[model samples]
Target: MGRTVRVKSFELVAKDINDVDVKLLHALSIGVGWPHRPKDWDFLRRAGHGIVAVDGIGRVFGSAMWFPYGHEFATIGLVITSPRTQAQGTGRWLMEQVFERCGDRNLTLNSTHAAYHLYLSLGFTKEATVYQWQGEAVSPPPPVPALTAELSSLSTANIGEIAALDERAFGANRQKLLALLSEGAAISVLRRGGEAVGFSMKREFGRGHVIGPIVASNDCDAIHLTAVHLRDLAGQFVRVDTREQTGPFADFLQQSRLGINDTVSTMSKGKRFLNRKENEPWVYGLAGHALS
Candidate 1:
């Protein structure tokens, strides 16, 4: 069963979002001057699902998303509250709406400074800090044959393997999201001995391009795959949210001239075990804080 409510003089309804709601969410993202494109919103909703708050006039004012991977893991993200409706309890209401549908699965979200305490009150503890590296990209040196010799462009045929790899790294199934994000974007895959092992993508976003969701067996492989795509994005503004644990990877981005732009906190309510291989750091860069 679904629940409904009324806030102030406006009759508010909380329900699953449709394409129309996504457009409204996109407007909110742009109103806040965030970098997410409308297409990105589509990707998230299409990949998993979300709940939205709509007023009497059918204007969507708030939204929260969750991605479920089987019965084990899920990521809660893309949370946005309209500036006009801030501090009015709409945010909390929207969060509750999402929680009701989350069931007993573990939940994760990357929090902005403003919403940290709210999440804390909800029992989401801090996991690790993530940093955003952004700036004009530089021309990367030619790929070392030993490294990129096996790297190739990604296509529809690669989605399954990529999603399986992502599950091992992200602990979630985000095939739909990856496919939409990779559409028309520069996607590179690394193969060793004819076996797919790593991948990276660069997409037009925010002020320019962003490289992210880069998953590889290790930092070296991650860097190589990302570098293969970075060379083509040279002199363009790019953003990547690097995990704090990967200090060397973050430093390499800085040395490559991507300045540390900002930071966000990755928090979770339940234990989502990302039991991964030791040598495989998996994700050297994220798609974005909103989606992570």
Candidate 2:
């Protein structure tokens, strides 16, 4: 079933995203200057549910997706409208569709500059700014701070080992999303006294590898967790989206050659999505801008 929406002269139909061809979705994202590869789109399709705005001829004009972590919480992302249709109400219509489907769940999303006003007008409050950092991983990535924990490789088979810690940092039990992200991803975990303290995952995304979902109790540990992967990715493209605007962890990323590329505002429609506490686990890096 689909609903027809008039955006200017064209009548766009909201179709189930799963039914649309992946190539069409890729083209839609490309038209908006996003870096989501077709494979990345496919992975996201598997991670959540979405809808695509299509026309009578089957050309997609927009898309929106929501990842529900549990019965009462969800993160909305991947919302895009064709540049040609910008400001004609297509984006608003698409968000309305997402709202109808998401029901009463507490919602959050990282809004791009173009969509900030639209989201704010719809009742989303700004939470924080996420900094997108990326560059060729430098050789011998800035010296690590004094050794305080053991860093080791983590296999997906033992994903449960860090579930509790990740939930603590992210404010939800995203074990399922972590499991999906774990596939083909290089994982590293920081352990102290034989107990897992923090972890990070490096995976193929967009134009290069993204190291993220980095969880730690402090800036030093977060740096070590991220550096463990950066060291292995020397000379390769790496990206990390973090909310830490200023701190030792942010400084370390700059020293590692990951320059700030862009920023997005984290907005929530219900309960606050981010909750950081002293000496408590925090997300040093995000899994992805949309996935956050």
Candidate 3:
């Protein structure tokens, strides 16, 4: 007699932008190295883009998120699968749903070695390598006096200024996405003489936090702002995903005793215009893999 295998019914749902639990499950699966967490779910849904896959019983088995930069491009991340259901194609199914939702829009993601083959099989090509730096607590660095623009939290009143500074640092306008920062997450900005010079935004993922798009006019200001933000987090482990060109920020992570947890390949499938360079002093970290 042949062994019997259960055929689970899979249903993919477009998550409500306000569905917090689903978002938390997605975050927990990726950040805390777990499939899902009950407590944080509500918080995650309110943070950003989220999608979920449920079984016949209505229990979520997998989830993913896409952080949109513009209608033309989005980064996908927070892909997770329940351990009991591994090798059952839950992950692939979830990714397929994400691709379908993305539909002809340019998509990008950072893949770990464990998931590289999976992404390659899905038509993603390697674009750039990103190193993760883990560091020890050090005395908070002093703010750059020359760049001494007082940094402030992003708000509706100052969003236009934030958008303009982002364009100057990132080489493109991301006003649409930057505008979303005022909604739920913490967005910090640096101002000197009442003019914005730099800014950073953060979102909650499970128990940890991810900070990025840390745009600044120079390395010193970037470092200062980052240190301040990290200090605010105190005991929590935070992930700062930055581009290779961001100078002392990466070095600071190294010198501070932060470990380089892993290096991910920033892969893409379609057009490629963003190339890594040494001269670009400003460093920008993606909010997450899905939104990069």
Candidate 4:
């Protein structure tokens, strides 16, 4: 006679993120209070490569993903571990797996408060703070400073027009990511002397819409670039993640009713990630915490 026996423990192995059902990944994010939907997970799968920690029966317990901009750099994100597995080194194990796969590439990530110490132990240095501003968009937004540049709609076919400027601000050639984000997104470009000086994109993400990757040389231009999109999304749930703490740009967002929701620390390994110059083009708003 034989009877089934229950096991008290099980081992987990790394599996390709794409190999699992999208719902599983969605559930994994939701388990940790993250707002990623199935669609969002699918989009992330297309945007980069990732891995999930799963047991023999395919029950996922943790996940880690990396978005590579080039041979020398990549952004790590979506690192999540089930609550039951916390304090057991699952998070660090998943990170080590990502490190192995990433090789010697320089890495950057927006670390939540809970994971800050872990990252510091891994040799990541603090760079900046990313504030997540989100709420119901105001119809008129707020009054902006006088316009100094011509604002115009930019077609996806002409994405190359802003590639150089974006590279200058982001410190990487991520035109590929920009093209993927431009799919079904509302894109606007700021021009002076017939040259593209700044640009922004509003796209569907998370609970509602996100206006981000706002690139500009100063606060005023950033305000105008953001206001143009807020004007169209009035009364809808909108979100923007930015590193600007205090300035005309931050004030404009506060007046627009998008209050600060949460913040994450931007950390980097191998090289300094953020370099703000006096008047050079800067990333006023990030595409997403994960994508940053």
Candidate 5:
């Protein structure tokens, strides 16, 4: 939609997304070879806001979704345009609507290379590079059986700790979104000296299980938390999106046979995107770009 050209007289109009419209959004993702399922989109919509472009017949041409992690920080994702509507202003128009809701909040997004220039034009600067790793999930025996952190499957009692650690690592409170994403999903917690220090979550996504929103005190605990949830997922396809701040986790995933799939530019348009302290635990893997 960067160019000034418009697709034929389709009479497109923008409107707030409704609960009944996730199917159309799902179609937009698959239209471009992405495997976002409607069920996952529905989960996001429970705590997110979105917009859709439509014509006189009410057919969807484009869609965009955003989650306001807090008053000062937010993230957007699942932006899709129907193949037939490229460069027709559908993507631009829908984004304008979503941005209005963001107001002064810092905005972050993981963008495809094709959309990188578009984001640059809109005031976002590159913050980091996110790599997507995925392949058949394999349960390889750990090189060292004694993982440093004591691993445990998350229970309802662990939600408070998980949410607090997530808030610190993510730079904002995503308690509601986390609750929805973790419901009935595999959650693993890392404890050191009988205290929760890190966690990882996995849920049904795309072709198989996707893990993310992982927070840890260090690389060792991060890999251990990931390994705990991934234990029984062998042979099932799995995916994780992560910034390359740690080479060991990426190396570990590769060692487990989850090959690097694609890379995206993680960009932000805001001030103070993250508040950090000396030696604070960092986010090891994102919930997914869409929800990040």
Candidate 6:
């Protein structure tokens, strides 16, 4: 019989809030073909929990990130394994560490085809199927009267306001995450008569761009913001994730002929603490590929 592989005894290092290792983590994530940015690390570190697997020789074998919105709701992402250590259970082990650390929280993750089975085995069931419309021309959206609201870019000056709006849109207080986004990613806010109404953010990736967390006060605003952001992409391809619940926006995507490229099932396990409103416009995109 073949020899059984012995589980490696690795130390799980929880990164210090706003630690510099975030840069290294971002690099590693990108190396694994994930769409991420150095600035994203700041957001993940502040708005989420991270665990790094360190071997006896002080080498990092794998890492996982969990972004929490409140006491019991979190979106997990950035699960990466060193190329040399793939299939060694490093990814699974890192996930176990995340579950152990955030057991009381309802977790969500957007798993790739290769990892979907692993996530399903962990009690995460399919909730919604996601699609990507890539390689299409980025056309400007028609002007809508309801979207005449003022648009603002997220910055340190307005992080609190941004966080409040985010909670209203996503149903949880993610102030720390806002702070991180302000630092690492580009965030745009839509305001009507100076009141925050919606927001969206984007992170750079090797392939192209992923737009998300496109939350708005109405369907029109969501479409306007998505069009504005997609227009900026111009020649490059863009990927957007729409939920089945956001009826209006989902309808818009369908009618616009932004055909589905691929889909992912949004699954969950454990009780969810945050009450997600069905009325809020569907999320046209998420903060990142991982968080979406």
List candidate 1 stretches off by more than 4 Å. 19-23, 140-149, 273-277
Over 50-164, each residue of candidate 3 has an lDDT whose tens digit, in order, gives 6665544555556777755556766777676666556776667667777777878777788877778889999998878777654434445333335456866766666787776
Task: Estimate the overall C-alpha local distance difference test score of candidate 6.
Answer: 0.65
Q: Where is model 3 poorest over a 10-residue stretch in terms of lDDT?
A: 1-10
Mark the regions of model 5 whose C-alpha exceeds 4 Å error after superposition. 1-6, 141-145, 272-278
Instruction: Please give the clash total of every predicted structure, in order.
Output: 0, 0, 17, 0, 2, 5
lDDT of 5 by residue, 62-164 (tens): 7788888768878898788888987776677767777887888889888998778878888889978888988887766245335866788886555776787
In lDDT terms, which candidate is top? 2
List model 4 lDDT by residue over 134-244, tens digit each. 999987777999999899999999999999999999999999989988886999999999999999999998899999899999999999999999999999999999998
Off by over 4 Å in 6: 1-32, 37-43, 82-86, 133-156, 184-187, 192-194, 202-209, 244-262, 272-278
Query: Which residue window of length 10 is worst by lDDT in model 6?
Result: 1-10
Expressed as tens digits, the lDDT of each residue in 210-257 for candidate 6 is 667788756778876766666677667566676543466655655444
The whole-model lDDT of each prediction reads 0.76, 0.92, 0.62, 0.91, 0.78, 0.65
Model 3, C-alpha of 267: deviation from truth (Å): 1.4
Ranking by lDDT: 2, 4, 5, 1, 6, 3
The reply for model 3, stretches above 4 Å from the true place, is 1-50, 134-136, 140-156, 167-176, 179-187, 191-195, 202-205, 231-236, 276-283
TM-score-wise, the better of 1 and 5 is 5
Give the 10-residue window scoring lowest on summed lDDT in candidate 4.
Answer: 1-10
Candidate 5 local lDDT, residue 148: 69
What TM-score against the true fold does each predicted structure earn?
0.88, 0.98, 0.73, 0.96, 0.92, 0.73
